[model samples]
Target: MKDRVTTPLGAVTLLLLLVAVGLGLSSPLDVNQGSLVRLMFVHVPTAWVSYLAYGGTGLFGLLYLMTRKRRWDRLAMASGELGVLFTVATIVGGMLWAKPTWGTYWVWDARLTTTALSLVVYGGYLLIRAMIDDPERRARVSAVVGIVGTLYIPINYMAVEWWRGVHQTQTLKLLGKVRFDAAPVYGWVLLAATIAFTLLYLYLLRVRGILAARDEAREERELMNDLQGDVSGLTPHIAGQGAQRGGAQHG
Candidate 1:
């Protein structure tokens, strides 16, 4: 398949850079936090995109099981992997912002704990796929796990909300009254990030689907070739049945 990342990734990156340039030329620098706050350009948006990725994965997983389509399975797999990556970016970005704000790198808060669990679960999912040798069995097992594992997302959100911590839930609600002081730039950054992440996820899914279909097709071809190449054992039982029928006809 043609490269998905080069086109989409390049476009999003160009857009991000152009937006940054515009912000630089026009907007005033944040007063209190200074440059560190700029990390929000990537940080906050990645958090929202990560959640979106997981939700999309869960939805696709359920759809795959219902339909038994390989494309859906591939999408769920790709989304799960991308979501895990975004999860890491979220944690790391949180730490970057948190260190200056919270005076610590690590915390035992609900948000961090639940996010950690979510990451581990998806990581285990990837591990499960890696360990399995049979492709069909792997798809079935992974699909079920992906579908069942979706429950964690809501729990994760609620955990962050319910538990008091230095951490704050991400605010992607851009259209409502501006939530943050840097709403204009921050919100635009998030929207761009969302579009970029979605494109990236989709590209990966399409590639994975094509690759999986090719692999399955290759396997089937090999099985057929092996059967055809086998001389004496081509149809041992079938040959026996034919012999019996011929004898009955003769008698």
Candidate 2:
């Protein structure tokens, strides 16, 4: 199948650009936060996409184990790595916003702690893969980590409610509801940014999967060459044995 970026990602890129332009012009000049709140368009959507990428990794990891297909494994691996990158982006961006709004760059708040722990977990996952030379073992360990690491996502989301924390209550949520100080145009802008970042995430995953597949195919070809060489060496000895058998039969 043709990759999504070669086709659908074009639509996403175009649409997101138009929405971003609209958001910039429509945002009201807030009395308290001023124009800085416009950063919400990018920040909130990036946070959502980070969760999406990791969720995809976990789902595909399960599918890979069930079907025993290397393609699914590749998808999972690519998503997991990309998820880590995006998760880091979300934390950094949150800190940037928090410094101005909350008056501090760092916090021991539940939400922040959970996200930091998530980073450490994934970091260890990556480090373990690097330490191991064998391919099969690496996949096995990563699959386990991807599967179990899912618990942290919810913790990150509910950290404010679940504990007395520095993080604010979720603004965009089902129960508590959201109250945005921006125009309806800004809402569309947020929707556009979410879709755009998500497309970018998958695009990166597909690119990484392509490189990994090439590396795997190259290794397989090398193994085939070694096997053929061994077979070539044994062929001469086998023919000599056949000749001796023929001589015994003639006698």
Candidate 3:
């Protein structure tokens, strides 16, 4: 099948880069953080993407359990992989931005720690999927892990406010004098970045899904070939036995 997602993905990426560059160049620097505020363009989007990917993994996993469909399992696995990638990005970006602001690259800060732990947990989930040879068992086991892992997302997100942490409180809020209210430009750029990252996730998921389908098809073909060979071998053995029996009957 022709890939229709790639072209739109490229377009979205180009637009994302353009908007990010525009924000860096034209938007006003934070009076407090100065140039360091530029990291927001990269850091925030990575965090957003991680959240989206992991959440999707959980959602698809739930669907797999309900319907017992291999397609849903493939989707859950694909989203989980993307979640790991973006989670690492979020951590790295956080470390880079943290050094200047927090006076340290690594900290046991609640939000950071929980976020890291979440990555490990999800990584373990992926590892479990790899170790299992039975497809049904793998899908069932991984789906449970995927669903449970989603709990960490909300916990990490709220860790900053729930427990006093070195990490700053969220800048964007939905109600009551949003923090980004003053910086309309930053808000718009952030929105664009969120959309771009979401599109990127969808594109990657589609690619991974295609790979999974191909792998399953190859395995099926190999199994069929093996069965054909076994049948051919059995046919010659049966014919030899029949000829011996006929010779005995003629005697």
Candidate topping lDDT:
3
Q: Which residue ranges in model 1 land beyond 4 Å of their true spot?
A: 1-27, 173-185, 219-251
Off by over 4 Å in 2: 1-11, 14-18, 175-185, 229-251
Q: Best TM-score goes to which candidate?
A: 3
Writing each residue's lDDT as its tens digit, candidate 1 over 1-251 gives: 65555566656656765765455444455677777766776676667767777887778878877898877877787788888988999889888888888898889889899988989888888899899988778888987788778888877766755787777654642434636544565556555555655565555556666676778789889989887878657679789999999999999
For model 2, what is the C-alpha lDDT against the true structure?
A: 0.76
lDDT of 2 by residue, 50-163 (tens): 788778777777887788778877887788788789888888888888889999988888888987887887777668767877777767777777777777778777877889
TM-scores for all candidates: the values are 0.74, 0.81, 0.91
**What is the model-wide C-alpha lDDT for candidate 3?**
0.86
Give the winner by TM-score: 1 or 3: 3
Better of 1 and 3 by lDDT: 3
Show where candidate 3 strays beyond 4 Å: 174-182
| Per-residue alpha-carbon lDDT of candidate 3 for residues 1-251, written as tens digits (9 for 90 to 100) | 77787777878777877876676667788998887777887788888889888999899999999999999999999999999999999999989999988899999989899889978988998999999999999999999999999998888777888898788877665345656633666777777777777777888888899899899999989999999999999999999999999999999
